[model samples]
Target: MPSSGETTTLASGHVAVPLEEEDEKRIFRNFPTFTDGASRLNPGRWLLLKGFKDVADRIYNFKLRESDVVIVTFPKSGTTWSQEVVWSMLHDPDLKGAPRSPLMDRPPYLEMEVDQWPTEVKFFVPPLFQAMCPGGDASRGTVVQMLEVEKEPRVIKTHLPLSLLPRDTLDKAKVVYVARNPKDLVTSFYEFSRTIKRLQFQGSLAEFADHFMRDELRYCPYWEHLREAWQKRNHPNLHFIFFEDLKKDSVREYRKLAGFLGSKLSEEQLARVMEHTSFSSMKGRDEALGKSDQMNSEGSFFRSGQTGSWKQKLSHDLESKIDAWTKENVADFGSDFKYFIS
Candidate 1:
């Protein structure tokens, strides 16, 4: 529930999600020639996008407290995987596979809807995510909604770029931002856009790459998005991690995350979380596949969970274009962070 002065609940049952006038305009693309000036996202982007204009206001518009734990990412940048990691680390280490509760329940995607998801994937994915959660959605509310309401520390997820979300998401709470290589992100998003038809039909990978290089995808201006966060890397509460690094050293990333969260993990429990979340383990599995009930499997969320999958598909001209764009846009991002675009 939003505190006073922040939200307005409609008698019609429509949640008046809060937003500044500028943010409100982003929704126009959903209706007309909407473009955030990045790439146009596929319909899959709309899955959680529905309530952001209002429902999201039900959550994000409220003032944030220090205890809130949020995971922010540009779409297709291992947002889902980071959700799983935070969920596991924040809860009881003893609870293992087939959790006591669903994953979404514990630390739900502030935006993902489980009831609408397919039966198989949503049900199982929710559990792994939920086990870490103390009670789940029934008691609290949506992840962002709960974060707005709670004084205790909590874990939540978001795919909105920094500019679009309420500033409180940054100024007041702890932010865990994850990014993946653009080539990988491009390939993954192409697959993601197709999952939701509104993004555009799956054109040749070359066509998609052109859109990507041009920064026309949803939540795009990819380099700018990453750079915004990168500039804030020095924040004590901010943890910036890469998907490729997590792929190579899951435990290392886990430990780094735990340190930022101020949660301690035993070596064995750390190993278990890493092993369970491995890309190989998650691939084709019901949870990662997005085939389950939680989300529409139509466009597929887990697009080629491999790093270099781009090399096999991208051409030299496009690669150069991508390279040039990254240099112009991302040159200022910290050196510690490297993109897998090459």
Candidate 2:
């Protein structure tokens, strides 16, 4: 499926999976080491998780077409919500048929490494594979392997920051970046990392907040990630949306997205998209696609999808620290997008 010969079909009837050890080593060598010069998987910092290296390479080498729509976000920053909205906007509900599986199954998280997921999470991977593969046999191929074969105007998702992203892909395709306030982003990210074993971030909230402040967390130095995108907000091909803004009025944001994607929807069509992408609606429909089996104790992916949930979780001191840090890094950085820190 990989036109560039990046994928391999195995003799055992599998494809692009069980990556060769050599490839893993080669891919890691390309990623920048930690700021503290520690192991790549150092606590709080991002690591090249299992299957990440291969997916990263595939994303870099994969051809980019102008019609492609890429959903970029820092982890847990309303990515799933945006994906559902975009997917709904792109397809005709009656003609194309309602999504048989979850939005993740249809749009596909480009960097989602199913094989690399923790064992408990792997149980849910089979359902995702069934949705993607023809015969419902997950053994057919890897995540990227399936994406490599997808049709044009593909809706892809990624957590990569601008610097690490493939330039051509951003330049040619429609890029939608969704970011949330650092407080909520960190809270959600912390909860998500704690749930997903692969992230290896085991610690108290205070410790996690400290790590975040030091820019030691995955795709962090949150201000910088937001800053980079903010600078490019005016770019013709890019559309930037704030999570709080969407939370306040998803209909307006959805319409903005439709306009950006060049999808002209009738009033009735827009209403349908809004209803389908609602938090309660998503929670009710895609439980399997929301949180994996490993996170059964935690709850759904639509966990309290609100703007100020941080007030309940974050201590006053941590909130102050976040506010001060945001003021220094984001507000004082000459960012016109300072309101995003809300």
Pick the TM-score winner.
2
Candidate 1 lands at a TM-score of: 0.69
* Cα shift from native, residue 55, model 1 (Å): 5.5
List runs of model 1 lying over 4 Å from the truth. Answer: 1-60, 96-106, 111-152, 196-202, 284-289, 293-299, 340-342
What Cα-based lDDT does every candidate model obtain? 0.58, 0.65
> Can you write out model 2's per-residue Cα lDDT over 61-85, one digit (the tens) per residue?
5666788898889877899888878
Q: Tell me the spans in candidate 2 whose CA falls farther than 4 Å from its real position.
A: 1-55, 93-96, 114-141, 197-201, 288-292, 331-335, 339-342
Global local distance difference test of model 1 = 0.58
Tens digits of lDDT, candidate 1, 24-138: 3433333232222111223222222322344444454545667778888887788767777777677655444534234434454655533223223232233333434455664
TM-score of 2: 0.76
- Count backbone clashes in candidate 2: 0
